[model samples]
Target: MNQDERMFSIDVQSVNLAEYSSKGIVLDIGGGGEGIIGQLLGDKVVAIDPRSDELEEAAEGPLKIVMDARELKFLNKTFDEATSFFTLMYIEKQYHQKVFEEVYRVLKDDGEFTVWDVTIPPYPGGTKDIFLVPLEIELRGKKITTTYGVLWTKSGQDMNYYIQLGERVGFEVVKKEKNKQIYCIGFKKKTNAN
Candidate 1:
């Protein structure tokens, strides 16, 4: 399927963005892909992605950076909030811990972090999650099949993994929401001194 026809959205509307809009700066990881979150949040957000080209599509107001999420360049306690939308699934699992740590480091005391991503059920029987599902589309009058699935299955992780990792990195899960295909989690950075 063409880019226009390709579906790409992770539900983050569950989080109360208006609160962050007035509180302080919010970091948006991978927003460069489509800039959907930045488009909605506007100047309150600064979006980052390693792919510079993708950032060109981001909405006008937010600051867009071509940087990797695993090692953010910002100084400690720089942001009041951070968010990742269906971004971790595309990154290798080995880097997830680092990404979480980076987010924690950049967030101010009492800062919040939110992530919305696909979930991998422990038991696959009734799951709507797809694994290499094939779709046939006509391109130039020729039929072509594209097999699509969540990226890096060998390194993909689940909601439980994130919750545990965040705890280890000084974040506490304050809220969680699950749907047939995805999970939305909100974590607040602990205030205790490390």
Candidate 2:
């Protein structure tokens, strides 16, 4: 089949995310589109996305900025917390490490960084050119139904992958959970004992 005629639908289970709230300012990476983090945190979130249109499409609650995750414009140890809600899957795999490092640099000592993402298996040798995942996200007593589609590619993204990245970036895992293909991980920056 031709690329235009090829498509694959991924079967994903519904994920019920626990209620989360931050005490201080939160740097929400790729918090555009649905803007779930911004909706939950309100003005306490500084939501950033590389595409201006994406930020414009998000709800009017956070202080939205057009910025890249790998090149955060804030100073070192600027934010008390950071989040990536299903955002890592959208980024190129090669840039994932840089994004983690940038988040580490911008977060305060002992600050928390939470992530929610899906595990995508390596592309099977077939005619499928696109992969689509239909998700039902339950949070704060609400159910959000959406579909995320991307071009088929080799992606070995799983919970273990993020754990290693967090460890390498001087973060200790504080929370970890997985529901089917979706996973949520919380990490805290290791404080320097100087």
Candidate 3:
């Protein structure tokens, strides 16, 4: 699935987590003005991404914005729910564990982090054209891409590797599935399994 399709799945997964809402702060990592989960949210939501220019134009009240995901400027235990939809995969695998640790550190006790990212494409070793291409969008006095597809040059590892990595970082395997796509949510746990 492409970015748009993965986004739709993230929306669905986030919607399915509605039962866990409690007015706690939610942060969307790699969440560049996406995730309609905010529309259904009853709590505060934060969207953090590196694309400041593109998302700045779409920013408005309540839905706050940030410039980067790796270097989140929030204090510890400042969030209840954190998400990285179809995001962490694009991140360099070497820092994958660090990313999970940061997410784990920021969330409050018992907080949940939902991740919806692509694992393997349709074929074992094949490529699927991305859907979110760079489209020239007219916003304000500037032209920009309403759609973007940069993963074409990227190579993603197998899905199970991420699950194992999350576990290594002391996140409990709350829920995981591979439906039409790969989806998983890991809850903070007390101890690591070494």
The superposed Cα distance between candidate 2 and the true structure at residue 181, in angstroms, equals: 0.8
Predictions in order: lDDT: 0.71, 0.88, 0.58
Q: Please, what is the TM-score per model? A: 0.74, 0.92, 0.66
How well does candidate 1 match the true structure in TM-score terms?
A: 0.74
lDDT per residue for candidate 1 within 1-194, as digits (tens), equals: 45433333333223223333436788999877556567667788899999988798766878999999999999998998999866777677788899999999999989999887665444233223344323332333234433335532434467888899888888999998875555678899888533
How well is each residue in 34-99 modelled by candidate 3, as lDDT tens digits?
433343352376877777763554344336575566677878777878877567756776778888
Model 3 bad stretches (over 4 Å) = 1-23, 57-61, 121-148, 152-155, 189-194
Worst 10 residues of 2 by lDDT: 12-21
TM-score of candidate 3 against the unseen true structure: 0.66
lDDT of 2 by residue, 39-129 (tens): 7878999999999999999989899999999999999999999999989988888999999999999999989999988888888767886
Q: Which stretches of candidate 2 lie over 4 Å from their true place?
A: 1-4
Clash tally, candidates in order = 0, 0, 0
Candidate 1 Cα errors over 4 Å, as ranges: 1-22, 121-149
Which 10-residue span in candidate 3 carries the lowest summed lDDT?
7-16
Q: If both were scored by TM-score, which would come out higher, candidate 1 or candidate 3?
A: 1
Per-residue error for 28 in candidate 3, Å, reads 0.8
